[model samples]
Target: MSRRAAASILVLTVVVATAIGACSTAPLDVGSSDTSPTSVPLPDGPRTARLPSADPIPVSPTPTPQLPVTVTTADNRRVTITDVSRIVALDRYGTYGTAVFALGLGRNLVGRDIATKFPAAASIPVVTTGGTDANAEAIIALRPTVVLTDASLPSANVLTGQLTAAGIPVVTGSAGRTVAGTDAQLRAVATALGIPAAGDALVARTDSQIAAARAMVPRDADRPRIAFVYARGTGLLILGGPGSGADSLIDTVGGQDAGTAAGLTDAFTSLTSEGLIKSRPDVLLMMTDGLASVGGVDGLEKIPGVSETPAGRDRRIIDMDDGELLSFGARTGDVAVALARTLFGRP
Candidate 1:
């Protein structure tokens, strides 16, 4: 992930989550429409939710895009899409790409963003440059029939404006993303593409997977405090506080959000020695690439006051793929289960 992508993780989630209130107790309404996920197979006590490494997206309910549909962009522009045969979805976390694939339209995607790390999009042409920033020239060169993008990218508004002027229709989803809006994000893409039924099916499947994973947490076990640290080197290190997507992940895994508990109100804040000590986290969670940027676990300990905390003293740091950690789409359930299994441990 680029440094820009890492920073947007904070920007995206907080924008839409401000009115939703507390991050820890906020619940995603999966609705009361279906039975429990017994058919999905619960774990055998110690472990659950085993997933294959490649993370294949199940394109069930075979999507048949019914274009010529009129949709409203996040910017309030009314866009009518006539052709989805050549589609381009872009965002900071690859969530937009995941949404398209989730709707069974991956084969239609002609271009991808830099943040797409999932195995399925491995061969797609990358249009974004250095970070998740849109390369206007590259994207325009593709001549996509329609472009699906969000404002999370640093230059998305300008890029979209340029694309609009070029006579290419652009359908913008929400300006940012959040764990609670996962289904909404997916639905927005599907709606724009005129495939609400397929979107509903995918949402149900994703919701079930997440529900099953959350059920694995031991009700009686003491919840561990987890701190999400975003590092891009010595000069730029931030913490995921309240309203940050990390709080939702921490809540999902039955853990306390250490940054919020430490009284940090802003979504992302510069990491300070005093703040680290005050959080008193049992484990420090980080993006995999972010950790590497600071020179790995050994180098992470060298930070001003990291070694003094319970997490640092014991070297209890858990890192996940940068693209996957905060994307909060398609693979969110698997991401939650992965973290839960590690933190909760074996029976």
Candidate 2:
């Protein structure tokens, strides 16, 4: 599809949008493949997926960006950036902000989104609010020279409009929630910042790390059935389907996607007990915060369809930090490694 059309879609849906900027176009072509859920045996021991520690993902040595960079943004606009004094990378997953840090330009960030929760950026002023939209006045106060963001935010248009009105250069792009898409995301951010070499270096490091993590999964082991669930109290209970990004992680960790296997066609669906039971997920994957919102493990089993499934019966739940688990950025390899260890390793 044309970039113009894609941009329109990007402005609408954060997760299902397939829009991308000119900086890195090819990587978005890789699509998520669905796997049918099967009644496979699990490791039977560990019931949760936890990282060894909460340390932020490591970064590569910083690189200098050759300035006066011109980029054809995802919204089909050519924006030339000459200053990098104050930058704010905003998005739903903090992918762009993380990329800037990986490129060694973290020091230039003037403001950050809620999802950019790394220690290095802990002190940066937050510009996003209400979990989904950004605060225009807060960003205006920072007077950022350029803002790197994408269609991941539901109010991306309004946010961009307000920023543009204030004369801040906003280059829109997408960090698709897929393993391959992460490569393009890093490259796209570097392109926007006039740091192609750094992007390449970061991508290389990410690739090697991901390969090592992938190697940890035993080829002969049985494929586990994983269902990605989004829970927010008793009000919102969504299931991950095709293009949800969870399916990619599930497959990467050597598991089949239960929602996809159960014929969920959309990226997200209002979860129903019958639908979940039909999928028969061996493991229920959730965001740490999302799990807690519903009152933790005990609360999750009490959900309508949860108690009838194998995952609920066995208390098989694997949760990661909401901000990091689906960020789909530089730390994907590390995330994969931790998940693999939990699903298959010894206590």
Candidate 3:
């Protein structure tokens, strides 16, 4: 079978499994290779709880400056960075610029993409508007010496082409959404900025914090059945399955991913009312802005399958900032801890 055909078959298999599990009385076993529902300890608690406000992670000391380096991008393009005075970093989730700032290079960043929030990035000039679509004129006017971004930008090639023609180096990083993917992103940004040591330091700190947070999750506690729904008015998507940042976050927070158990393999897929109702998720995860767009809990309960599901009946929903929840940067550990606290009521 062709790769595309195999992928289609895999997705179909998962979807079928999900439909079965959703209708069954058992909990979905997402950690298993086969699509099946397995019984696990179900923690006794109210279906819904208010999420606590999260504090930002403290910034580390600035690293000694390093410059005059050449780095290869994910696209196999080699770009040399001779000056780190004025850097511009862009990505759909703002992970690229956040990573740069985490490496103690915030002072050098002259411009950022629209999604680049947190730390000192909020004060920087935003060069993109419409979800990673760069304004070439606005970026060029900043006089950036180096542009570090990910492939998530819709007009990435065009913007990079324009910047390169203007004699600025453009390096594109990976847009991976896994834990290791975040590490690779940080390394790529650090390499482009000629600060490998700083990158290592930031990664180490992030990894350590994540480990500490993971340790706090109770091993004997019941793993909640969680489903992440991306909602923008009438447009709704279910994010789960293997190889997604959502999956990793769920695992870290000791939750079973309903989408993965249903046999879905993609990062996100259209949510069906039947699939959602059958999945029987105990908790629904959503982006704060997305939940607001749908008119909050009352509005969410009005959605087709949502009203019939256990989550909807119990009003069990957790909402996080769209950018921070998946950015997987310096605050990843904190995010995980916060989610765990909300789900299991553990610090």
Instruction: List per-prediction Cα lDDT, in the order shown.
Output: 0.73, 0.73, 0.67
17, model 1: CA deviation in Å? 28
Task: Write the residue-wise lDDT of candidate 2 on 60-164 in tens digits.
Answer: 455676888999888887888888889988887767777777678888988987788767888998777765578889888998889998877767888888888
Candidates ranked, most accurate by lDDT first: 2, 1, 3
Q: In candidate 1, which residue ranges exceed 4 Å CA deviation?
A: 1-51
Highest-TM-score candidate: 2
Q: Kindly give the stretch of ten consecutive residues in candidate 1 with the minimal lDDT sum.
A: 14-23
What's the true lDDT of residue 257 in model 3?
84
Model 2 CA deviation exceeding 4 Å by range? 1-41, 45-48, 51-58
TM-score, candidate number 3: 0.80
Q: If scored against the real structure, what TM-score would every candidate get?
A: 0.82, 0.83, 0.80
| Tens digit of per-residue lDDT, candidate 1, span 285-341 | 887777888998889989988988888887778877766777677667667766766
After superposing candidate 3, which stretches have Cα over 4 Å from the reference?
A: 1-59, 220-222, 235-240
Clashing pairs in 3: 14-263, 18-262, 22-278, 22-279
- RMSD for each model, in Å, please? 8.7, 9.0, 8.7
